[model samples]
Target: MSGHGFHVHGPHDHELEHAAHGNDDFASRIAVMTAIMATVGALFGYEGGATQNDAAMFKNEAAIKKTEAANQWNFYQSKSSKQNLAELAMVLPGADAEKYKAKVARYESEKEAIKKDAEKLEAESKEWEEKSENALHQHHRWAQAMTAVQIAISLAAITLLTKKKWLQYASYGVAGIGVALAGLAWFHI
Candidate 1:
């Protein structure tokens, strides 16, 4: 028994280990192919987890940016209301109309700045959302690749048990598909 937790050799692993050292060429080939497929599956699994984590982080960033954008928009609205009141003050009789006009101008400029900042933050949030979606898509691709590789390994185990040449060929085909999926993941397709 190994010291590592959750590490248990399956019956197929024992058979594969035995076949790997056996004199039968067919068994040896299947064993080697299954070993390679397992390695590829592990790598795909790792990438899938990493991409999922990245997606979560990107989504969190998008949420934060969206909140900041909302805050800026609220600030812009507040400034607009203040500007309207200042304009009304300028119309009141005996009011400091010059001071009210200057206050209105300042509020107008501030609102413009706030509007621009909010728009920029909204764009940033959208960009982060797109990034999160892409990462999720990539994670799905990696998961598919890992699934195919696991199926290939299973087929290899069956081939080893039954000594079926056709099963071996099918396992090879599935392994190729797994590699292709991994390629698609790498390319973000």
Candidate 2:
């Protein structure tokens, strides 16, 4: 019975205080870990979105190039048809035979030029397709990373709820995999 009502802690009180301190420390660790996981998850989500956008852009470019190549082929076919008509006209009666011959020569030269252009367009289209495929592959990797990070975040939440140290470790393992996948995506391999 002290006059100030300030008593010294007994052994039981000391043990309770130590346990409370430990619980607070554990809660702090969980909070810190959750925060870190959330930050990384957000970054992974953003990168996944960006990669998907890049893939879509590349795909659209490929489609455009393919359309251009198709158009060039169509033009080439039309020129070929015209050249055929000119050859037919050249075989006709002698009234305009020389003129038809000159026209046939011009059409042959035009066809040659058109063939070169169409070939160039086809090559360009193939290059675009290759680029698009590469982007898509990278996008898939990024998506996988995003998924792993999301799972890690969920596991972290569960760890907090269940107070399971094993779950926390598992969350870290999943997060590591996510980070690795993100690195792979960066290299676009």
Candidate 3:
């Protein structure tokens, strides 16, 4: 019996004890690797969530801008219709012919101003839509990176259970890919 009050039964038990010690070392190494992978995976996951939130915000803003643009276009159309009615009134031979002509000219100017404003709003709306698309694309990239990291972490867990060096290597390779993807997401590429 040793100081711990435990004794090996025979030479076979001694060999088994040595093998167990070796396995312990391997298990400790796997634990350390798993901790590192989990840390990295958590960080990437957070970034992915943030990017997804940003994408949603941008999409909402784009929708609002588009609605505003549509309203502006509708207003412009109303002005155009008023101008057309004024032109028809001018064609009538009546005491108000001169007045109608003046009204027509005023409506024309107003329509031109309204058209410019509507066009400007439409352009702005398009710009917002483009921004939303870009954010959504970035979100997808971040999500993919997060998925890779999660898969790597799962592989690491499996490697720990199986005590397989090859599986550990595969986990590390997958982790490397996850890190690369995280880098790309960080740069918004």
Best of the candidates, TM-score: 1
| For model 3, the run of ten residues with the poorest summed lDDT | 18-27
State TM-scores per candidate.
0.87, 0.83, 0.83
How many clashes in each structure? 0, 0, 0
Could you give candidate 1's per-residue lDDT for residues 27-59 as a string of tens digits?
A: 778878988889889999999999999999999
lDDT of 3 by residue, 103-131 (tens): 87887888788778777777777777777
Sort by TM-score, best first: what order? 1, 2, 3
Question: Of 2 and 3, which scores higher on lDDT?
Answer: 2
Task: Quantify all predictions' global Cα lDDT against the true fold.
Answer: 0.95, 0.82, 0.80
Provide the RMSD of all predictions against the true structure, rounded to 1 decimal.
7.7, 6.2, 4.9
- C-alpha displacement of 134 in model 2, angstroms? 1.2
* Candidate 1 structure lDDT: 0.95
- Report the number of the highest-lDDT candidate: 1
List candidate 1 stretches off by more than 4 Å: 1-22
